[model samples]
Target: MHIAQDDIMQESYPTVLQLYKLALLVPQSTAVVERGFSAMNDMCTDLRSLGQQTLDSLMRINLYQEELLEEDLELVVDLFKNKKERDMPL
Candidate 1:
């Protein structure tokens, strides 16, 4: 039934995004995937040491047999933010 499909879609993605209209979130729909790419590209584009460059690749390249997902980037950004907050002196 249509209702069952609706429920399935809802459970599959974030609530903020409409399940039927996922294609309209151009550039990005839920989270900013490009920002991280730009960050990684900027970091990787210029390099003096090979180890740091490899690290950037590892962080940007998703290891789960895919490029990357929006949720994955958000989690990475959140992790970065938390670290920054924890390191900041009160």
Candidate 2:
């Protein structure tokens, strides 16, 4: 999970860095994505011009992040489960 800007330290970083670093992941869940989209929607409510290329790239990143978050959401929530609640809320 280490990221070094120095070319010499390239080996310090993992041989294969994560596609989406869970350690660096923020809010790291679908809830955050929903919140972010809500904020972006509100922020851009008055936006005039967004270029097609920029928009497409944004769409791609958003989709990738959303998918990553969704995929990890359940496994993460499970980590907080208590033995008593193991079979409580599914």
TM-scores for the candidates: 0.25, 0.24
lDDT at 78, model 2: 76
**Model 1: per-residue Cα lDDT at residue 63:** 40
Tens-digit lDDT track of model 2 for 22-87: 456665468867865775564345655567686656656665787877899888777767335555
TM-score of 2: 0.24
**lDDT of predicted model 1:** 0.58
Specify the poorest-scoring 10-residue window by lDDT in model 1. Answer: 62-71
Error of 1 at 43 (Å): 2.1
The best candidate in terms of lDDT = 2
- Runs in model 1 deviating more than 4 A are 5-31, 49-57, 60-90
Error of 1 at 4 (Å): 2.9
Please provide, for model 1 over 58-81, each residue's C-alpha lDDT reduced to its tens digit, 9 standing for 90 to 100.
Answer: 655644325466558889887888
lDDT of each: 0.58, 0.60
